[model samples]
Every structure is written in C-alpha cells, then in structure tokens.
Target: MRYRFESELRRWEARLRDDWYFVDLPPEASAEIHEWADALPRAGFGAVKVVARVGGTSWSTSIFPSASGVYSLVVGARVRRAEGVEPGEVITAEVELV
Candidate 1:
C-alpha cells in the first residue's frame, strides 16, 4: 500500500549528541501504518519498514513510533543532499509499505 503526504522536514538532537532529521507522519497515516505493522511479522524496534520517495529520490527506511501514537520517518543525510531538502521545508513524501 502507498500513502502520500506533505510534511515539514525537522531536525532534532539525538541521544548521541548529533542531529537527526525526520518528517512526522500524519495521524491518519500513522494509524494506517500501525494497523499494517500489527499484521506483519514482528521486527526489532517495532519499526515499520517502507520504501519512501521524495522528489526524485527513493530509499528504504522505517517509521519509528513516537509518543501519542505518532510516527516519524527518518531522512538520511544522503537523501537530504540529493533532494536539496532543508529542515523546515515542506516536502511531499510517498511511502509504500513493504
């Protein structure tokens, strides 16, 4: 299944003292992903694997659960540079459950 949405790229400090980037999934999308994940064979970290496309780039990643039933898609540095996306910029992302 595929879901598309626009979200602002955000950056936050990770526990290791480095910055991490992500795009938060919408609540509805999060619910759908949670439902799909529940049906999959469990994996470590409880993350839902997916293929994400942004701009002209596509990569494999996972959506991590956050507080209050929310999820966030991590944006790697490679993808950010390739897509010319900066934190706080709104970008359209297409996520396909794999």
Candidate 2:
C-alpha cells in the first residue's frame, strides 16, 4: 500500500534533531506505517533511512530496515521539489523500507 502525509520539513527536522522526535502520528498514518512495515519484508527491504535536504545540504537518517517488515513510511527518492519547502526541509516524504 502507498502512504502519504504532509508535515513541515523544519518541524519534522526539529523533532528528529533530538534523540526522541515525537511525530504524534494520526490514526490513519500510524496504520499506514504498520502496513508498510509488514509489506517491507516481502519487498526485499534491506535498508531503511530518511532522505532530507536542508539548506542545500543533503543528509539522510540512519539506515533502518536491514531486514524486512520494519518500515516506517512511504517517502521515496522520486518526490519532486514542492513550493514553500526548501531543499532541506523534509516535508511530504515518500519513504520505502528497501
């Protein structure tokens, strides 16, 4: 299944900047995350990570999902540049476990 959500990149980054970034995901989004984690195992998910661009500096979260069935979201690398979001502000992401 595909999952999509919109959040401020700066806000998200701010949360992640610390060890415990509370996302406070909604019910639908949380369900999607669980589903994606379940599906990742079958999709050959060998790695999981977050790709964020901040102030022209590209950085990614620590790799996750070295195994399957452990995804967190549906943000991927194909997302286009959106308005109001700087290159580094990670908003409306498309992450895949693999």
Candidate 3:
C-alpha cells in the first residue's frame, strides 16, 4: 500500500535524506517497520521514520517495533553533515531511521 508519512515523519525523513543518511536500523528493524507499514493498510508504504539525533559515535541506533517484540534498536543512519574525523554533528532532528 501507498502509505504517506505523517508531517512529523516527513520532516525527519527530509532531513535524513538531505544528510545523505538512509536509516541504519537493526536487522530486525525491517520486521518492526514492516508491521507498522503493514498497518498502514496500503502498498508501497515506506519504513517508519523517527525524529532522533545522533547520540553516539561508533554506532548510530534507534528503537522500533517488530512482530517478534516491542522494541529494537538497530543500526541507524549516517551523518551526511559530518566531515573529516571530528565526530558527527547532531542536528535539530527532522527524521529518524525506523
């Protein structure tokens, strides 16, 4: 189904995309994403995007739902704005990886 993201999610997604970072959620992230997307009751539904900022350096992560359980924090997006090796810069969070 064609699930349109809510304004909140859309805003975050735009930022993430602009930053050149696709969601890097966990391997099971897809499972949760699929559940939510499936709930959309449509086809071609994109994954669930959240509005979170980068917290750690080594690994960017976020929590999402899954048919198997409640929450799962998987590999999240990368910081497109970050340059060199000087740690990633956190933005005012627009969208997040699902």
Candidate 4:
C-alpha cells in the first residue's frame, strides 16, 4: 500500500542527547497501517517497514507507533539536509509499505 500526506515536521529528543524529527501520519493512514500490520509479521516496536519520500530524497525506514496513538516517520538529519526541511515546516511525504 502507498500513502501520501503533508504534515508538520516535529522535533523530539531522546535522553536529552539525540535530536530527531518526525511527521505524524493522518488518522486515516494510521487505520490502514493497523490493518496492514495485522496481516504481516510484526517488527520491533510495531514498526511498519516502508520506503519514504520527502522532497527529492527517498529512503528506507519505518513508521513507528507514536504516543499520539498514530504512526510517525522519522526524518533523519541526512534526509532533512538533503531536502532542506526545517522543524515546524510542513512537508509532503510519500510512504510505500514494504
């Protein structure tokens, strides 16, 4: 399955050391992901494997379940730099389930 949407790039940190950015998938996409995950073998953390595209850059990653009760895609520093994306800026993402 393929899903596409626009979302705000949100910043977060882990253990106050690693800074990360992610975009939350819309509720409709999350619902589809739930069904997709159910029919596939689970990965760690319920991550759904995908190939994500942002701007002109595309990379392999996974959509992770978020505390917000949805799925979110991590936009790595390399990807952010390649795409010239900034936190709080809206970005359109294309995710292909793998």
Judged by lDDT relative to the true structure, which candidate is superior, 2 or 3?
Answer: 2
Q: Give the TM-score of candidate 2.
A: 0.31
- Encode model 1's per-residue lDDT on 33-88: one tens digit a residue: 78778886445688887889999999988878887687788888999999999999
At residue 26, give the lDDT of candidate 1: 91
Tens-place lDDT digits, model 4, residues 41-77:
4569989889999988999888898877789999999
Taking every candidate in turn, the Cα RMSD to the unseen true structure, in Å, is 1.6, 8.5, 12.0, 1.4
Off by over 4 Å in 1: 14-16
Give the total clashing residue pairs for model 4: 0
Q: How much RMSD separates candidate 4 from the native structure? A: 1.4
Displacement of the residue 63 alpha carbon in candidate 4, Å: 0.6
For model 2, residues 1-98, the per-residue Cα lDDT tens digits are 33344543322253465432211223564455555554444433443344543234343442233123333332233322323344334455433233
Report lDDT (CA) for all predictions: 0.85, 0.38, 0.34, 0.89
- How many backbone clashes does every candidate have? 0, 11, 12, 0
- TM-scores, each model vs. reference: 0.89, 0.31, 0.30, 0.91
Q: Which pairs clash in model 4?
A: none
Q: In model 3, where do residues sit more than 4 Å from their true spots? A: 1-19, 40-45, 56-98
Give the candidates in order of lDDT, highest first. 4, 1, 2, 3
Give lDDT for model 2.
0.38
How many Å off is the CA of 8 in candidate 2? Answer: 1.2
Of candidates 4 and 3, the better by lDDT: 4
